[model samples]
Target: MKDIPEGCMKKRGILFTDRQQDTLTIAGLSLQERMIRTLQKAGISEIFLLPQQSEEAIASLQSTSGPVVCLTTSLLLDPRLIEEFLDFPAETTEGLLCVVPRREQPLFPLPAWSAPADDTVPLPLFLCPPPLLPLLVEALQQGVQSFPALFTYLQERTKIRPRPNEGRFWYWVRGPGDVKEAEDALFQTLVKETDSPITRLIARKISLRISRLLMSTPITPNQITLFCLGIGLIGAFLFTIPHPLAQIGGALLFLLSTILDGCDGEIARLKFLESRYGGWLDLLCDNVVHVGLFLGIAIGLYRQYQVPFYLLLGGLAVFGVVASVATVCYVTLRRKKGSGPFFTSVVNEEEAKRLKPGFHLLVKINDLLARRDFSYLLVLLALLRKMDWFLWGGAIGSNLFFFSLLGIYRWGRAL
Candidate 1:
């Protein structure tokens, strides 16, 4: 949640549409559906499709109850970007905002004055307040048909600060090519900034394809999460067998688990099925698989070499992993004031700013070490007949991870 600016009024969504244009399909979903889903995810209080919704929404819009976000079906953009835009720190509740291309120099702190528009340029989105809704209704009654004419009319009455679209995404679906462009923007959601090299270059490519196919089916994201969790646990059990062949097989299965781990998120994001329970489940399942693999490796090594040290190393790894999970949960629920996010960064970004310079660098490296990319290395070691080496290194590294987080919790500004 963010701090609300004084006089900030919540906005309802008004999606102006042409029935034919709105019916145009992208990835099996209609454009209207996509637009509505985007607004829903952004926490819009009420969403109405105009022309279709004019009779009902106009009365509500005319009452001065709240502002409304007006956009048309002719355009599409990154939903995440719209979410951020809605949360942009506008100094006043009534100031208008015009969405423009990223190539334009956009005003920051939204309520600031915008550069003069060329008038020939077309804008794709708007933040229309209640005062303008009646005039909008009047314009509609008086034969203002093209959305551009209505936008021009509205801007002439009140100034609109330009809010530039983020990223290389905002598309106007005027032709077949534009719809394809919009689809490309939608697919871009599969790529995450936090992705590690292996996961980004390899695992993500595979998982995204799998997610695309699964999105057409009845299987839910949580189901994929549980299925992958089962696969991971089975692989861990295989790690307990003493044979070299078994070790290699277990490592292979483990790698598969790690790769598919991204699929659940991909599917959830694609269909807008993301949930708090799913996030918590993903985190818990990953940790369980991690602990299982550590214990299994120790047992397998002990059975093969008859060394008690393997068991001790296993205990250390398990302790480290459990302690780390508990610490993260504590920080998320207690310190951060909310939960349900995947624990990608052990230290939160805002919290990182307050740490001493030396500790900040150390925390960044530790956080990088925690990414799942190392799963690829474990498989490589297995192929080299070096499973014991992985066990040794992972044991030490896991303990180090816990201690790093513990230090942050105890001394850093926040964990």
Candidate 2:
């Protein structure tokens, strides 16, 4: 997709119609605020709001640039739909008076100059040249009070285009049920586009619920990271106790920490609160937890059996964990240096297919060994009182997996 120029739509103002009390609560934001935010995100900096009670509302909704296109508030518009207007070819947009249409009757009032239903079932969105504002006012004075009517008038008097609805997702925020649906749609959009299988199948759902409960609060993503870090450390400490019950507790806590870890990212994406510092903090905390947990398990096993081998095995496990992280960093840095940060190629299907078959096989193997989903196996081992087996498998498997990954990456580069 071609990148839309930043602030391309700022010159063309947005007009929002329909102002109702119920429109105030969609996604916990007032209709005016929602419209403004949606438009701003889509690179439309100027907005012309025409709420009900035109005289008083106009005074408050006054833009420094003045009203450009009058629109309705009862409709929740997807920003992408507005982006389409900004992306149209210059010739198509020149002197263009366009109305986006939906088949269903809109919850909000159509503009006084709207065309008839037979002409076009106009949505509460319009884009027109600023010069056309006077003609619109004249039509309104002549008792032309519907978007379809205005459209017909424009078609006869000027070159007007009726943009057909192309199945873009939009909602009428008419009541509580609509509000819930809008919120769910927004939440789904905020979910990370790339997620681990475990995250998608389990952790994300739980985390999303938690994130929604806390998103409106003062709590920030960094705070959630700190909370996850604390829980992880406590879980690691619990793993140091030489008892089956303690091991089970540690396992459960670790699982809880993993689930909670997702919430910080969820909240960050949902609230548009993502930050460089938050990303680094999350990475650092995860590594800390991994190191602590590996060492704790080793120490606990050594204490239980009074064996030096367990301590040595623990050291190897810690080394493997560190090496896995270092390998990924090294690969990412190398890719950045060579191809200007194609780190996404690690997950990109076309890039993966470009690799040699041997490397692809190793990649598949690494997925099974190194995925976060592997944590479930550890939890099972802990529950089964097979910590010794888990330690040995984790130490050997993790090192082998990462080393294999490094080798495969190099081989792919050579090919």
What's each prediction's clash count?
Answer: 0, 22
Off by over 4 Å in 1: 1-9, 87-99, 102-121, 130-134, 140-146, 166-168, 175-180, 335-340
Global CA lDDT of candidate 1, please?
0.72
Model 1 scores worst on lDDT over the 10 consecutive residues at: 105-114
Candidate 1, residue 45: Cα displacement in angstroms equals: 0.4
Leading candidate by TM-score: 1
Q: How accurate is candidate 2 locally (lDDT)?
A: 0.64
Kindly list the per-residue Cα lDDT of model 1 for residues 1-415, writing each as its tens digit: 1233455555787777877678887654677787787778777878877666666665555543455677777666566666666665435444345555333432212222345564323345676654455666676565554555666666666666666555535566765656665676667767988887777789988887777677668888789889988988988898899987888888888889988888888777766777778888898898999999999999998998999999999998899889888888777766543323557687777787778667877787787887777788888888887888888888888888888887876877654
Model 1 has a clash total of 0
Q: Which parts of model 2 are misplaced by more than 4 Å?
A: 1-23, 34-91, 94-170, 175-177, 190-201, 327-345, 348-371, 404-409, 413-415
TM-score: model 2 vs. ground truth:
0.69
Candidate 1 vs. truth: CA RMSD?
5.3
Against the true structure, candidate 1 reaches a TM-score of: 0.86
